[model samples]
Target: MKQDTALSERPAVGATPTGPDPERAAPRYTGGQIRNILIGLMLAMLTSMLTNSIVGTALPTIIGELGGQDKLAWVASASLLTMTATTPLWGKLSDIYGRKPLFQVSLVIFIASSVAAGFSTDISWLIGARLLQGVGMGGLVSLPQIILGDVVEPRERGRYSGYLGAVFGVSTVAGPLLGGFLVDSPLGWRWCFFITVPLAVVSFGVIQWLLRMPAHERTANKIDWWGATCIVGSAAAVMLLLSLGGKEFAWNSPVTYLFIVVALVLAVSGVFAERRAEDPIMAPRLFRNPTFVLAGLASLLVGVSMFGVMIYFPQYLQIVKGMSPTASGLMTLPLVVGMLSASISSGMLVSRTGKWKIYPVAGMLLVSAGFGVLSLLQVHSSIALVGTGVGLIGLGLGLSMQILILATQNALDRADMAAGTSAVTFFRNLGGAIGVSAFGAIMTNSFSSGFRSVGAEAIAAGASPDELAVAATGSPAAIHALPDAVRELVLGAFNDAMHHVYVVGAPVALAAFVVVLFLRPTPLRSHT
Candidate 1:
């Protein structure tokens, strides 16, 4: 493969050859080449980000059709498991092999998975497709940052990163509307999977043409395959417990305890494997750095709060408040606006002023405050009120999303750039997976409890105990199909469960606020 002149050129004096921001004499790609590459990268980013959350509003409809309401959280959990497992590997391999090939290969994986998911006839097939999609997503999300580091200097990257964040925000906005429309229309939820294929094809062509990398001499080090496998094993164990413990079996049951033991053993083994690997996925050493540790923790908390809300708000609108899928998605526009605006404006501000500490601190506080607002949500809340509540979360997340990664990158040495970046990203996704599943467990439990607690008069009004039990775990359609008094009971139960979830989980955001308070401030490096 032909190499770019700047990419292949020798590193400037005193610069690390693989530094996140090498001392470049000029950009590797210029003018329209740069623009097209970025357009490809941004569009690729959108494909994953858009697909990730688009299903939130339509999830109920899909479950209703698939007849697997009990498996609701697993739909999200399966993808999260594989993505979290594979994110670090993608970057590590990219360092050894060229970024372009891995990127193109990942896109192909994504496109193939999307097609597979579109044709799924049951929940198992859908979940399997999601797992495959996660494998591809691991690359799409990680490589752009690695490649951007390859091409752009740190100072100028802020503006471009802002544009990337904007793509995230815009996609966040567009996906739900599109997903809801697709589900509500003749296309059905299947189209949600089908929609990504063409955009991915365009991205595949763009990256193949415009994106280039210096030909990397393959690393002689063994590829830490054991460590990666162990990590995936432990992660999958934890996800299984989180998604299944309380719902599928009693938390104290033999099944739950057995899985817990298995997870702990695997996690311990994964840690030991990492310590011994020649090319460890995430060096055990990063934990020793206070900055690295704190950043990862903060990122984890933000993930829990951000993703927890992302999963539930649409459910609240559609299930508790009786909005159609399309209408529920439309209700989320305010949130999209807040997040997109905050991300773009904050990116510009940081690029120009070279200050970033205050943003995440501010963002975490807003997130906690937003969680407080969501805690007050009710079965009868107005659409405007729900929108305002969720908008705060979007605002807080937008401000911190790019800044946290930037902060972690600033704290690490050039050689550890990939490790540090992947670590932070990994924790963020792991937290999301655990948080969404954990909260889903809690909400579902509360749903059952709430149903049982309804007054005898309501139950006596002709709702079967078994039927109400099924309603607790089933879709909105199931709940709505019940008799009048039982329908009210079910809606009331759902609303209460929603309220309980936010109230119980809001403390994690506050914990993030405390952690962000301790993030060491470093001087923002100008592009050298």
Candidate 2:
């Protein structure tokens, strides 16, 4: 296979090429070769995504054994902070060094950290291991998309991206069920961490054996260390603020103000450093592209709806409907099915037509509609109604998720491919983090309000205020065990709280739809 000149060469700093070289063409691979490489990449993605979900399901068991209840939230927060912070750095490094080697390094890091996590003797140890694993997970998440941009034409990339989306959907569904089984069986929660190790190892081997790409040639090897540091620092500060604001410190506290100041300072420093560096981590030039800007904004907003629902919907099932965790997981099958179907079908349609804008436009609309539908759910809404609302949300996500990245890649110069791809991913992640925090605050306030209203009624009915308060804050099982009238009041409060969350989400999704409308539909490129 002949390597394209674009693949081997980097544009000089601040140079903007008008378009791809007409005389040069991308490296060609047989369909089987592409499929084989995708198999390895998908395995790597499955390993990364599955581990996060599995750990989420097993957290209760882990806390029981480790006895660090105070540190329980850090187990997840540590990884997310690192992963989001390092995402762009991995992409920039891949653009400088080449994707194959950096991806392999990430696999090694993930595998090692997974082993460390499984062997952890305490909560602190597990959090440390998870933080390390997140650095690797960042690469696993972003590099595959960049690599795909390198090997496949943007016109045909959707078909393959859909496959990756399917892998994500499967992992989302399988991880919790598998984690529960492990926790209940003699294998225990440790196996949740241990199980991903072999899968990642196999993926590492397969990528080594099958993945090949041309090395990137650069005129200078200077790294923008200052820019990287500031970017990471800024991202970490923001994440910490969002993760801990309402829980650990008041939103108006000095800690919150300190984090805000640190983030802003680092962010300003990063921008200035990028403008001065010989080789910037996130090039300033990419922002000039309208496709990149709009796509990134749309992705950020879509992420708000996506993660907010995924986090809160299960609470509705368990708390309001009194379903167990395992049963709630099963009930989400409609969402999985809708996502898988929409992703694969939309990808195929885009590949066949070479036109991509309609899907996202329609997708965001459906997401807004889904939010509206979900807002209508009540304490005793039928199972079918709940499924319909979630299914709509899943379908909307499927249609928009990869397509935004695809549009951004298609619009960028080959030299900016990795950085541009990572930028969009970073936005999506940042949005999810922000959405989770903001929506949680909203839920807390709404729940409080609902509880007070219902508490007044319970008091009038001769229910003790202290018992009502305990039931309001208690676990789903505990709430279900309350007296019938009090239980109804608690469930009603929860249902109203969820309604408020979804109602707010609907407008966010609609805002994303409005953003998507401004995207200029550039024709998909036939070659990388």
Candidate 3:
């Protein structure tokens, strides 16, 4: 018999089946069906991971063509803001509806946005499409893990989860390359958006044909509209606060203060709404599990370190070490390699040993140590040294990422799995958005402070304030175009500011290191 989408309480693995019903003894997946389903899921997983990194190298070109030189950062920020806010809703909806329709809907939305984005004639148009694209990306990011958990047992999920990590590696490693090449070619930057359309279509077809679950018999399932509204509102407010504050508006400005208050109010209201909700989108019971709480914290802190490195490290190389945009992206490849190898290795080991606690603990320590090493990098640092430092952090991420998911999933019953997974992902992505904004603010403030003396001396010597200001806030090319003496000073300022950013982040990583030690050593269940 097929299981209902709103899953019933089932026997724990190795326990006796309830009531000896003949249909309850059937295996979850037929062998042939399982292969097709996993392949379908892998494609959906690839699209989301690919979307994140694909436009990285092309963003400058995209903004250049679209005439959004001043609004360059919003290109990426828009997608992240929407995706992070919508994730929990996707997970909860899959619980109420079957996974296939929701997943397919997301694929359609993503493809349509990609098509729209490719045709964008202005920055506002492109940002609007990307914001819509995030709605799809949200589902892509969360639902694959939930679907895999639906099909695979906890002990076995590592192998599949490692595949997700592998796609993450491949995507990060290759996305910039593809984007750069396409942007440089006559096909131009728009092709970057066009490329994913075909992939999305294939993913949609594969999912529709191969992915199936029992239609959620929704006789008793009620949508918690108030809880949903408050959670999404609060999340949107928080993301907006992170993305806009200190950049568009002062940190202490009325806009910032208003959002802070709005987010807090909605969040409190959401919590109360959830408590009384018949089918809470966020289960209160999940938080009661120490594993879920610790794992959520670990995911959040890990996200900060992860996004912080991705955002600042490239700029560090380009400005401080005088590498080109392409080279800076390529220089980060070792991080991808380390992450892929470690994630797959840890996954396999966990499956074989059925033990996972030590990986995250050790991984967090490595992350802290890596960030500490990153703090020590100088303008004169060699590429090999940079790779070593970044690779350590990547290895830590590989070890920690999937393990945290597994830890949280193992703690939950069947009904809570989707919500639990979404909650973890939401926090992690939320951390990334916050990390980008906070660290960007740090970089900007530090650069200004570091350049103050340089700027004063230059003005004293008769250079234009406009020129110096452009050098301080401009792109790598602009900075490099300055006079030799001014260029060197600008470079030093960037190097110092980035180094300080890493130092500030090291303690945050250490906090994650400390938190993971408290994770209870729960035994892995090999069967669902």
Candidate 4:
């Protein structure tokens, strides 16, 4: 069996190495190499988030051109679905195959798919491309974290993590603006997708040159291909069910029931497989730690609230509030700023004091409170008030989301760090997928019913009565295009929809807050 003993076996200065020493095989990065790695990883991370946020400012234009405002949630959900479901698989594979190849391959896949997406002429093609791109994106996000885990000890990992948080902060702040500008310019919305190509090409080249790691030598054992297949199948099915339920299919329909049954069976099989597999995608043993379990749950909830909220808020600003793409991006600056502040502050505090639980505990409280406050938003509310609400939510999310991962990694041994971290990340992303689907449905249904009640065209000119009703609630565009009487009706419908969505999110946040209360405090580990 191969073992990594490189870290412990470094010789004294000028010492000679013995023949075939295990230490000789460990990948060592020079300072320049490390810089290359960070830069490469940063580009990859930037690409992972860029597509989603960029779309936020471009959505109204894209939907208007593509004529699929009704399918808007799918744009976000598609990327999240593949990214979330495949995360654990990516982590496990990286462990078996080593990080360099997986990382590079992920970039290539993302780059290729992104280019295809930019040229897509219709919504279906774009959504399909996004799904493919998401598969690559899943690895970019997860593999970098795993690679960081390999090089850094848990305690000092926060500094690198702080770097990652900074990347996320910058991307979230910048993605919408870049996306909006592309949409508004002669380049058009397609450029938003094309923009990732050059960045990815450079990232791949950098990683290939700078990341020279020893081959991962493992005992000959059968890969649990079936288990991985089942897990992916199960995750995809469940996400699809959630995304389509109450929108495309009735919750109680035979198709929905069939999908539900398949999801459950495959998920159960996956659990069993994880326990028995030599290298499980998600090791069952990690959940044995109570801190890991709670932190994972908290992470999941945070993803649901945090990602779910971010995906749609720009649309709310642009469509409902009559803001332009640039103005809408600017309006969201507070949320990004708040996230940056919370992440930096929490990281510094954790590093300085080595006390970490307080942030997530308090953060969750603020999350619930923030969402509760956001629920008060109305069509007539001031932009500053709306930004304040979003910023508060961002602050809570920043404080809690990554901290839970940090706590979970700290609680586990070095060997378990990647799996544990990936698990929490996977579940969180899963929660994001579920939340978007659920809340999207809630908004759609509420808007449709509300619009119908007010009689803003029981049927639209080009759309079905049901479709017209949904569009009325989805954005301000629908309302803006209508006559004054109909516009007022659509506005009322949107208000009801937003209110209901917030109501759902608030309770989920509150429940997460209660869950955090039970988490036992563990000191953050001092190593990578």
The global C-alpha lDDT for each of the candidates, from Candidate 1 onward, is 0.77, 0.85, 0.81, 0.75
User: What is the C-alpha lDDT profile of model 3 across 298-381, one tens digit per residue?
Assistant: 899988988988878888888887788778778888898888999989988988888999998888888888888888887787
Which regions of candidate 2 fall more than 4 Å away from where they truly are?
A: 1-23, 215-219, 459-466
Q: Clashing pairs in model 3? A: none
Ranking by lDDT: 2, 3, 1, 4
The top-ranked prediction according to lDDT is 2
Superposed Cα deviation of residue 253, candidate 2 (Å): 0.6
lDDT of 1 at 59: 85
Greater lDDT among 3 and 4 belongs to 3
Residue 152 in candidate 4, Cα distance off native in Å:
2.1
The TM-scores of all predictions, comma-separated, are 0.88, 0.95, 0.92, 0.86
Clashes of each: 0, 0, 0, 10
Model 4, span 1-528: residue lDDT tens: 122244344322112234555223223444455556778788888888887778666777878888777788687568877887788777666666666777888898899899998888899988899899989988988777777665554555565565666667678769988986788799999888899888888888888776655545542266778789888999889888876677777898999989989999998998898888877767788878998899888877887887667766766776678887678778877777877888877877777777778888788777777777778888788877797788888788778876787778778755566667778888888888778777877877887788667663534333346545555546456657665555555676777788888888888888788878888777765443
Residue by residue across 366-393, what tens digits does model 2's lDDT show? 9999999999998888999999999998
Query: How accurate locally is residue 334 in candidate 4, as Cα lDDT from 0 to 100?
Result: 77
Instruction: State the displacement of the C-alpha of residue 220, model 1, in Å, after optimal TM-score superposition.
Output: 3.2
* lDDT assessment of candidate 3: 0.81
Point out the higher-scoring one by TM-score: 1 or 3. 3
Please give me the total number of clashing residue pairs in predicted model 4: 10
What lDDT would candidate 4 get against the real structure?
0.75
